[model samples]
Target: MTYISRAAKILSSRVSADVVILGPTVIGEGTIVEPMVVIGHPVRAKLMKALGSDLGIDEYMDSISSGSQIGSNCIIRSGTVIYEDVVLGDNVETGHNVLIREGTRIGSGTRVGSGVIIDGETIIGSNVSIQSMVYIPRGTVIEDGVFLGPNVVITNDKYPPSRRLDGVRIRRGAVIGANSTLIAGIEIGENAVVAAGSVVTKDVPPNKVVMGVPARPVYDVDVFIRKRAEYEGSKAP
Candidate 1:
């Protein structure tokens, strides 16, 4: 009972009833799309140019990509809105009510939790886990094995209505705790840990742990991991 657009190419995918797929999209094998999912929805380029041109926010004009591609073994939950020009690798899972904008590239084994809003032009690598209510702005780059806890807000714009907006870069294996806010143009280095409720305004070095407002270096990441392991072991029955 799937309603696929005549222009779309589905390759042995599973789409639930009430799902709409428009434009030129390609779905790979073993992909499961739940009900109320919108794929390859059309965007009004004229509207963007009309309103954004006056504000110097013309960067969103090229946000739409050429085609939409979902790889094998991907699970797109209900109420998910995925725009055109996005590519997803195998074994990706999305929770309900997720909004994924255009020009996003997601690698294999990525799990996105419910109510997550990922803006356009985002590049996410393999084995990343983004928890619920996380807001990832456009132009963000998340490397492999990054873990983002719930309510983590990653901003892209340095100033409102400015054309010089840039997103944050999160390196491989970094862990961002819940309710952390990351400002634009900052880099979280590999294996770094940002503690909960931290407001990160500057770059974080590799293998370090940062906490507090305008988060500063607290300790080594390796030490924190070791301590966590010890605590978990102590709690074992």
Candidate 2:
């Protein structure tokens, strides 16, 4: 059954009846919320569950949820769970079964593909394209026009289960290839390209192309662009 909190401000006309909107969530105009999408789910719900609180779902959410904001003209696909305190800018789109945790902010025109998991407190800039099955941990920052290919993994903890957390920063117009694993605390410079299946451990300088296990610099972005143009020219019909 779908549940909408009395405090929610729903301005959209395309919300499905099976969607759950809790707390004081705001659904903007022209947005399409697919079936089984849960918005404004409280982050403290887990704590309450752990503590075995007897409070009902509505009562608990009302007490602890700060709510979330879904901007105008957005598309939130099915089975997506957006935690409280998350903000999505206008024209953002998410694929099916995406999980966005609390305190996350996504800018306008960003596309998060299916099965993507974005942990809390991350900032994603405008027009970023994240392909399918990407895992973005907490504290990550993706600048505008960045392209992350399928199955890209971004880590925040240097050591597993450690207290210290450092995010990977992808500068504007960078392209991270498919199946790449970006380690913690690395900065991918603007317009840089990471070749497919690379395990990036260090910061990549601006406009360079890197490949291999440790992801060494292979060439500059100018060379990569020229090669790309040549390849495209060959493929022209």
Off by over 4 Å in 1: 46-67
Tens-digit lDDT track of model 1 for 110-130: 999999999889999999999
Writing each residue's lDDT as its tens digit, candidate 2 over 1-237 gives 588888999999999999888888999999999999999888754555635667876666655677899999999999999999999999999999999999999999999999999998999999999999999999999999999999999999889899999999999999999999999999999999999999999999999999999999999999999999999889567
Clashing pairs in 2: none
Residue 214, model 1: Cα distance from true site in angstroms? 1.4
Quote each prediction's TM-score.
0.89, 0.95
Best by TM-score: 2
Q: To one decimal, what is the Cα RMSD in angstroms of model 2 from the true structure? A: 1.7
lDDT (Cα atoms) of all candidates against the true structure: 0.87, 0.94
Q: For all the candidates, what are their Cα RMSDs to the real structure?
A: 5.6, 1.7
Backbone steric clashes in candidate 2, count: 0
So what's the TM-score on candidate 1?
0.89
